[model samples]
Target: MVYLDNNATTRLDDAVLQAMLPFLKDEYGNASSTQHRMGRKANEAIQKARIQIAQSLSASDPSEIFFTSGATEAINWALKGVAERYTSLGNHIITSQTEHPAVLQTCAQLQKRGFEITYLPVGRDGLINLEDLKSSIAEKTILVCLMAANNETGVINPIADVANICQERNVLFLCDATQYIGKTDTVNLQNIPIDLLCVSAHKFHGPKGIGALYIRRKRQPIQLETMIAGGQQEKGFRGGTYSVHNIVGMGEAIAHSAETDWRSIANKRDYLEQELAEKLKHVAINGEQHDRLCNTSSITIKHVLSSELMSQIPDIAISSGSACATGTRDPSHVLLAMGLSPDDAKCTIRISLSKYTTDGEIEQTIEAIVAAVHKIRSNSPTWMLFEKGLLD
Candidate 1:
């Protein structure tokens, strides 16, 4: 099977699995219980993983990184933590309409609790206007939540500009870097000044059920209330039995990513897009005019139902949209926010790549997609109507 849905998750790397095997078997120990040798070993592993993740993001120190279940939990921690601590100063938060359900749902919850949320709009290219963000910030605005890369379209946000604007306005900036991690190096704290950033290990070929949140604490230490109330783990921020094996896997994945030639993924992605455009007509790539992640392609084929095309190419693993939002009748909120009609949104399919993706795989997938589009459109009544000038 051709798996082109890396954005949903990646196959666990062999190196990462090997590193985690020892912890999963004989090295089982509670990281918090450092009295015994096994426990001490686990604690050391956790710290080493912390440093690995910290250095990967160019963070100032390892203490700023907090482990969580996944990026969803980290996102909740960041948004709700800021709301709990900074409500006295302000109750407004600014974010984009194209944000993930994690961010959008968390912000919606905040709104129900009396916070004002301004969801900035994106143009057809799926990018938030920096000026709108600047104008949205009020004295009551305490934080601005934006994503580094869109999960659906792969359109990159101007995070540096957003961070600069937030810095000038004295508002905290939280970036959801779930799709951005491992694909690029745009989330460096030293360069972007993002107050909070969240990443999932599984996005980068690590194990699932593990994620990290980087909270800025060096120069401008921001205060946030604890989200998980239980123990002294994560420096009293979260409480739970540490998943030592997963953490170790995450570190190994990060280390492995450094050696990968990601530029090759870009080449394959561009080749796939060019081949599709050449073989198929009435096809448009969303966010093509703007900078996007090198490994993602969101294409809309007019009069083509993504559901039908995907059904035709069952062996090829692609997605009609975000995995989290699929299986529902509603169109993608991200595409709608980017000015796509519901019909166009339904016509769009997301094809994401990874280091494991090959030139042959890309070619086969492109041929499959081109043929499937042709087959789907041949049976589509709407295509016939449009061809006969019976409809627009």
Candidate 2:
């Protein structure tokens, strides 16, 4: 099968698997244990992984990085922990409508606790207006949550600008960089005024069920109320036994990403887009005018249902929307937020490539998409009307 859904999750790199295998077998020990050699070894390995992740992000210190189950858990902890800790300072938060459900749902939970959330709207290109964000920041606003790159559309947000705005307002900035971390250079984040950042291992070819949150340890030290209380793992912020294998895998995967030729991946993505445009008519590339990720292409076929098209091309692994929302039949909230009608949103599919994706795979995917879309559009009543010049 031609796998074109790297945005959802990437295959584990061989090096990463090799690094993790030892910890999963003979070297297994609790990171919290420090009395014995085995426990000390595990603890040292966890610290090394933390340092590796910190170095990858160019963070100031390894102490600032905390491991979590994944991006979802990190996001929830960041949002809820900050909300509870800073309630006396402010009860209002700002975010965009195109955020992952982790952020949106956490904001919803905060709303129940009487914290007001202002969800800024996005344009047709899936980018937030800085002016709208600036205007929304009231005296009660304590935090601004935004993503570095959109998962579905892959549209890169103006995070530096947002960070500057937050810094000017003296509010905390939280960036969900799950989609941006390995694909881009975020190592020099010290220059940006972001306080909190989230990244997932699986999104960057690491094992699943492990991620990290970067908490900037400057100025006031970005205080947070503990979410899980038990052990002193992750500086007492998160309480749980460390998943040593996953952590090792995450570090190895990130290290491997540094050697990837991203330009080649971008070339493949561009070639795929060019092929799609050549083969299909009235095909809309969502967020085409914006600065998007090099590996993602969100396309909408004018008269075809995305589900039907995907069904026709079963050999090509693609997604109609996010993997997190797989069972839901609703249209993409990200597309709808970008002014796409429900029908247009339903007709959209997200195709994301990886560094391992080959030219041959891209060619096969394009052929499959073209054939599938043509078959679906031929049976579509809307296409028939448009062909007869009876539909606008």
Candidate 3:
């Protein structure tokens, strides 16, 4: 099968699995207990993995990093912790409408607590206007939440600008970097002034059920009230027993991202889009006006429903926008926020690549998409009108 839904999750790398086998088999020890030899070894391994994750994001100290179940959990902790900690200062938060459901839903929950949430709108190219963000900050605004890169459209936001604006206003900035962290260099902390960041290891070829959150403690320390309160695990950041094998695998996976030929993958992605677009007419690419991820393409075939096209080509693995949601009638919230009509949103297909995606697979997928779009459009009334030279 041609796997192109990498934004949903990546295939776990073999090298990462190999590095975790020792921990999964014989090195079972509680990371919290370090008096004994086995416990001490596990503790050391976890610390080393933490340092690896920290360095991957260019964090100054490993203490800024802590474990979570995934990006969703980390986002919840950051949002709730920030809102609770700064309630005396303000009850207002700002975010974009195109954020992941984790952020949107958490904001919804916070609304019940009387905290005001402002959702900034994005343009048709899936970018939040910096001017809109600047005007949204008020005396009551205590936090700003945004994503580094959109998952479905793969359009990168202006993080450095967002950080500068938030810093000048003295508001904390929290970024959801789940889809951007290990794939690109934009998540650097020494440069961007992001106070809190969320990441999911599985989004970058690491094991599932493992993620991290970076809390800035230098320059201007960010103090968040502990949300997951229990024992002193994670130095009071989180409360849980360590998943040692998963942590080791995540460390290897993220550290190995530097060795990937991402440029080659980007070329393959561009070639696929060009070939398919030439073969089929009335095709448009979402986020074509802005810089996008090297390995992503959001294609919209007019008069063709993505559900119908995918059903016709069963061998190609792709998503109708957000992780297989286009199969239903409800359009993607991200696409809608980007001003896509419901019909166009339903017609959009997201093809995301990874290091494992080959040139031959991209070529084959291109041919399959061209054939399927033609087949699906042949039945569309609008396509019939276009073929008859009755419509432009």
Q: Estimate the TM-score of every prediction.
A: 0.98, 0.98, 0.96
**Model 1, span 100-171: residue lDDT tens:** 999999999999999999999999999877778877888899999999999999998888998998888888
The lDDT-based order of candidates, best leading, equals 1, 2, 3
Q: All predictions: root-mean-square deviation over Cα?
A: 1.1, 1.0, 1.6
TM-score result, candidate 3: 0.96
Q: How many steric clashes between backbone atoms does each model show?
A: 0, 1, 0
Q: Give the residue spans of candidate 1 off by over 4 A.
A: 218-220
| Predicted candidate 3 versus true structure: per-residue lDDT over 1-392, tens digit per residue | 99999999999999999988888979999888888988888888888889988888889899889898889999999999999888998999999999988999999999999999999999998998999999999999999999999999889999999999999999999999998876665378989888999998899899999999999886656768775778788877687788999998888888888787777887888898888778888788889799888888999888788888989889999988776343456888998988888888888999999999988898889889888887777778988997889975
Lowest lDDT sum, 10 consecutive residues, model 1, at: 183-192
lDDT value for model 2: 0.90
Candidate number with greatest lDDT: 1
lDDT tens string, model 2, 78-99?
Answer: 9998998898898999999999
Where does model 2 exceed 4 Å of error?
none
